[model samples]
Target: MLQDTFNLMPLWAFVAACGVTLVAGFVKGAIGFAMPLVMISGLSIFLDPLVAVAGIVLPIVMSNLLQVMRFSWAEARAALREFWRYIAVICVMILIAAQFVTMIPTQTFYLVLGVPVVILSLIQLVGVRFHISPAWRRPSEWIVGLISGTIGGLTGTWGPPTVLYLIALDTPKAKQMLVQGVVYGLGSVTLFLGHLQSGVLNGVTAPWSAALLIPAFLGMRLGFWMSDRMNPVLFRRATLVVLVVAGVNLVRRGLMG
Candidate 1:
């Protein structure tokens, strides 16, 4: 099945996608976010958008799982308890949204995915301080979680919304990675299962998605290595800059297409 899917693509394109996945993994490892955004944006360049999405689903799940495992069980449980409400929102909404993957138009998908990413990244880059009083935090989580899940389902990218929500809460750097892993890890589990039920991850796409895991893991190791050595502030800013660029490109494609 995998051979049949790959056979449809030029050899060069497949090789290129593997490289793209590696870079995506590296970015995820360094930053603890944006893997899905990077994978979909890069792979969508050559592969059919739907196939591009399916290919990255497994990688997202694997990387996120590894992320949580980096922390101990007690830490993981604590993060989950803290963010459980938002996680619930993401899980339920993502499954609901996943059913509509093929139902939405491609142009609309791009627009929906790109616009929020650009806005969120720009907001962060500007250094706006969001003092979320305890009053509005719960409601905000639901709203953001819904948006993230819907976008995740439609375009296979949900990191931006989640990131914005966490930053707004002023979550510290280390906790941020753990929470992101827990939150996104849970979502990835749902995403994988949701897509399976929705017919998005069948015989053909399954093989392709699994195959991309090689580069994803390799790139993530390199990124994890760099994360230990690099300045967090600088690397985070770099991630935002990349997000801005990728988001703008997506917006352009949506408008042009």
Candidate 2:
């Protein structure tokens, strides 16, 4: 099964993909986010897009599980309670939108997805006071969750928007991390199921994803160790900066393509 897929790549390219997985894992461990962004972007540099997507699934799901485990059940339940509507919108929308991935125009899809990520990350990095008023919060949750779940369904990335939402709320840092985990955890589950239906993750690709888990987990451990020494504010600012840069790259590719 792995032969028809992973064996298509040169041995060294596969090794490099492992390295990329490690780096992506470290980023996630340190920041509690960005693993999917990093994994997909980095792995795509050397592998086919569908292959790259499949490769990251198990690792990302496992990473989010690790994150969810960090919080007690009470904390997880509280996060679910607070963000339930957004979660519902995101989940339902993802299921519906994901089934249509093959029909969406690729370049337009990328632009639609990338532009918002770029804009939101730039606003946050610039220290702008972007906030959602309580009056609009419920409506905004549905709207944002709709957009987020759609992107996640079609592209397997739903992080930036969710991050923007949490940041806008000025959620406490620890709580924010837990919320991210919960949101991402749910999104990842949907992504896994959606892709299974879409045929992106199958018996052949399963081993490749499973094989990549080693480097991802190892890198996460290293990152967790280093995260203790970094300032929280600094880490978040850095994450935003990286997100902006990534968004810009995505936008550029969408335009150029």
TM-score against native, each model: 0.95, 0.90
Model 2 misplaced regions, further than 4 Å: 103-113
Whole-model alpha-carbon lDDT for candidate 1: 0.86
Tell me how candidate 2 scores on lDDT: 0.81
Output the worst ten-in-a-row residue range by lDDT, candidate 2: 104-113
lDDT at 154, model 2: 72
Top candidate, metric TM-score: 1
lDDT string, candidate 2, 18-38, tens digits? 998898888888888878777
Candidate 1 lDDT, 1-257, residue by residue in tens: 66777675788988999999999999999989889888887777677777888898899999998888899999999998888999999899889888898786787777777888788888878887676778999999888888888888877777877877888888998999999999989999999989998888889888889989999999989989999999977987888898788888888988998
Error of 2 at 237 (Å): 3.3
Which 10 successive residues of model 1 have the least lDDT summed? 1-10
